[model samples]
Target: MEVKKNPNIAVSRNSSLYFAIGLNVMLLITWLSLEYKTFDKPDVLLENLTLIEEFEEDIPITDLNMPPPPPPPPVLSAPETITIVEDAKEIEETVIESSETSQDEKIEERIVEVSDVDVEDIDEEVSVPFSVVEEVPVFPGCDGNSNDELKACFSKKINDHIIKNFRYPQAALELGIYGKVFVLFTIDKDGNVANIKSRGPDKMLEKEAERIIGLLPQMKPGYQRGRPVSVPYSIPINFQIQN
Candidate 1:
């Protein structure tokens, strides 16, 4: 059999309400005690307040008698003297030569004799594109080749030349400078490499690339329409320092 416990001995739900009421009562009592203990504030005196202005002493005016500044000096004008000359010679009129003279007249004839020039001796500058050339240049060791084969052989020979003469500059190698140097050179009508220009990361590398390109052996000149023409070629030389 289960025995039921007494509910009054346990905490009731309305106990919180009693605690709240007790807290409110304590606060009310503290406020009442504070109000009753406070004395009446002293009565504010209603005396009439008048603004008293400070007396400013009268200052005496001083009369300063200063002499007037002296007048500026007068400017003197220079005298204009009119001197008349007794005798003056009149200028004579000059006579100009007339340009309407006859052809038979004895006038000085300036002869500007120009000699006949022979333009045939002057070689006309001609440039032909290497890609569309009638006959491509042949490398020194690449003779006995057709046009297309000659182009391929020439490219191979140029690369081989660069490789054979490639030298990294000491300063560049020490500084770990490595880059591709574009070498532009012109193959003249005489088959000699000329007008070499190179651009690279450093001056030393550019100079080295220029030197290699300048060492290219003379080849047979490319011809277009039965006349030799200059051919511009560009090649890139890579300068790398092997670790």
Candidate 2:
């Protein structure tokens, strides 16, 4: 035989409704508390941004990903280089002359050369005219033989002497320059060359003319009234180009 056990259910249909309301209120309060306390739990471990997040705790995005930013660009400053050069220069020289007094600096006077005159001065005498001393011989020393032939012969001789000795200045010929040379001379009673000179246009030619004049030979002495007399003469020498 089955023992009959009494079923003990304290909630009755009328109280069931009140019990359900209380239970529902309790459930709501529990859910709210759990949500405030544990619903937001996340990972707190630092991690690489490249790695996947698999934890249930809170983790900051900043903490996980940043690479450091590249170490603030390395502090830098421009480098400096120096250049040096050596230069050369020339030195100038100065000279100072000794100072002298006016008197000390004065130059000495030059001496002058005076040439002697080549002619002799004659004395004049006054006399009463006497019978021309017989007109004796004025030509041949007291013998009045006026020899025209002798005069002509001497003139010819003088001409020959000049023609034979006349010379052109060699220096001028070598230099290819030419000119005329003039000379003044005196022919005494004894047809001789005297007071010879060269007053030419050029120095060399003048010298040559003088030389020729000096080379003249003596001639027969001339007579004027039985006495030798001096006579003036001239000579001309022409220079020309040589072959």
Q: Which stretches of candidate 2 lie over 4 Å from their true place?
A: 1-156, 189-191
lDDT of each: 0.88, 0.61
Highest lDDT among the candidates is held by which one? 1
Residue lDDT tens for model 2, 1-243: 897655565446458799889999999999998888546678799876796879888766674665666657777898897865446655567888767667657787999998996998773321211112112112221222435444444445555766788666667778877877777776555556577877767788888778777886664344345555555556566776767
Question: Which pairs of residues collide in model 2?
Answer: 42-56, 42-57, 42-58, 43-57, 43-58, 137-142, 137-143, 137-144, 189-222
**TM-score result, candidate 2:** 0.35
Candidate 1 per-residue lDDT over residues 1-243, each given as its tens digit: 999978877568578988999999999999998888656899999999899999999999999999999999999999999987556766678999888978888988899999999777778978887888898877888865578888888999888888888877888888889999898888889999999998889999999999898899898998999999998888899887776
> Against the true structure, whose TM-score is highest?
1
When summed lDDT is taken over every stretch of 10 residues in candidate 2, the lowest stretch is 128-137
Clashing pairs in 1: none
Those runs of model 1 whose alpha carbons end farther than 4 Å from true positions after fitting are: 1-121
